[model samples]
Target chain A: MKNSNENKFLSPGHNACAGCGQLSAAQAVMRGLNENIIIANATGCLEVTTTAYPQSAWGLPWIHSLFENAAAVASGILASLKQKGDKKTKVVVQAGDGGTFDIGLGLISGMWERGENILYICYDTEAYSNTGIQASGSTPYGASTTTTPDGSASIGSTQGKKDMLAIALAHGVKYVAQTTTGFPDDITNKVKKALSVEGPSYIQILCPCIPGWKINNDQAVMMGKSAVQTALYPLLEYSDGQLISSSLKKGFQARPAGEYLKNQGRFKHLKDKDISLIEKLAQANIDKYKI
Target chain B: MKNEKVSLITKPNTTLANKTGAWRTAKPMTDLLTCIGCSLCAKICPEGCIVMGEISESAANGKKLKPKNKKLKPKTDYNYCKGCGLCTHECLVKAIKMIKDY
Candidate 1:
């Protein structure tokens, strides 16, 4: 929401460590918005990392609120802006995995059903990364976290990450999509498209966390690209129940999700058969995205 | 309030598909209190955007080089930033955001 002609994000100083894909994913979304846009960021990695107590990395007009209420506050901002004939300013809400899939679900759904023009971007680092690596609804099956510890027969998260895309579609929002940090250009473009659309828009990005996910800072983007290659995460766009463009799959042969997991410490709990299950799950994701 | 932003393009090459690549900007700011000054951003900056500044060379990753100035101030050059954001994204102090002009 920080707006200059060129540097709309106002990212001067931030404390998010390297390999924190949340920063990049968040910046990508902001870069794509109109310079006049205003943003409401939820409490999580993006909030803690960008807006430190005295200073903020934000160059745009941004407000950080309770994790569960970001969408609602953003919705209110949109209404107020429209009421004043400030129709050109775009309103966006940024949330993390914990807020978007768990605590904030009801509010997000309500925003969708209301068909507010807000563009909700979830920078899903896949857990409650700020507090600690705790499993949230967005956490993928077999991934390790504080809650899903690496122990005997305990292959981290047991269920697939909730299908937020499908859920958004069910809400019948004008637009919904999935993206990853490895695909910055695609993510930026989608953000722009969502902004142009007339109704509520939802896009979730797979933001890999360095410390939380137990991956190297250098390996982050490559891991993200690999997730899509392995079908652990696919690139695609959707609207009103119709099929839209699917970002490049590279169809480079679906590597097992285990391959994607191998580089990260989060999935260290996984064993051979458990890894196989992850492979199956990744395949399932690939199959679903093929449409 | 209708939140009014456009959707990100699904295609890869549209003009709207702005690239967020590697960084080459200058002035690698790390949090002194939090940063051990590991020089990770300096090591990762492909363009060598960072340099030794007020702090000793031993204390920082590199020299106190200036960030290439651009349309935006506080010293930012989007021309060189590349958006790789490798420096701040990996900063031990968590200081960096690829904040530059469009």
Candidate 2:
């Protein structure tokens, strides 16, 4: 029996914006998975775009719940699979940073605490991209968003990005990694590795949003690379509470944070002083990661 | 029972009926001669409309071209492409151009 669809997972013809970094990264994530998996997706950009009424882009057994309940939903799915004594079918959760870091944090922590064999992927756009670019818990400092608009009297996004990796580690997740849309191969490899590990695993991917970041449609890939090169968000991996590998270890000399900040309209209002302040954040990452 | 309806569940990959290509104001065209066939365009395409196709006489006007890096060239499905120009902008050899769609 032959299926008519050619795409193995997230299919084409979905209504996501052109050059969407999140969707592109999703393709990479899908590339790493086989047919033996079920995905519980949160209510966010990925969900709304793919699963419009009477149409779905997903080519797998996917379930969508409320924004804050994807982790909880996955837990239920895991329980069902356990009851059926099914070991081959993997359970996965997909969420935007808004869901993972803010709305769904409690449910995610509970899922992690139970030590379930689930792979949770967070597409970190840094802001609430689907909700008109509002400030999310993952939103970095000095970046303008709808809620954190930069003005003559103020800088954008007063709060720094929440350290999600530390929080995941604190929960004792077996595998944790971070990558960007720029490195699709790395994203796929990390996903494969995470799935191989037992128990809960977390992979955070920095996905640039076109309108949210005030970037040209074609610039998403470039901006994704720049984010990594600047050390604002470096490619990282942690296994069993130990720093295992990083992009810096692969001989990437960190570029200045200003180079990354200058490209986006979100950071256009930042002066040299403001940029240097942001640089301190990058420096802190470099120091903390021992890169 | 034959007329029973499934509730709250849609068929998989039914979004294929939604031709998002109509939203494009521009379209990407690749120069076969200059293309290195890195397949980055196909890899990065959000629409997943770009597929790497083998270069044959039917594609190259009866002249065989030597492979520079890869043998396959990107063939875009305009019915789904939104003309994001990611291919044109990210082409390593500057082979793709964004032409206004008619």
lDDT: worst 10-residue window of model 2 chain A: A1-10
TM-score to true structure, per model: 0.74, 0.95
Model 2 pairs whose backbones collide: none
| lDDT of the candidates, in the order given | 0.69, 0.89
Where is model 2 more than 4 Å wrong at Cα? A1-6, B1-6
lDDT of 1 by residue, A185-250 (tens): 678889999988998998989888888889865566667778888878888898777767764353
What fraction of the true Cα-Cα contacts (under 8 Å, chains A to B) does candidate 1 also have?
0.01
Model 2 Cα lDDT, one tens digit per residue, A115-142: 9999999999999999899999999988
lDDT over C-alpha atoms for residue A134 of model 1: 88
Q: Which CAPRI tier for candidate 2?
A: medium
Each candidate's DockQ: 0.05, 0.51
For candidate 1, give the docking quality class from DockQ. incorrect
Candidate 1's chain A scores what TM-score? 0.94
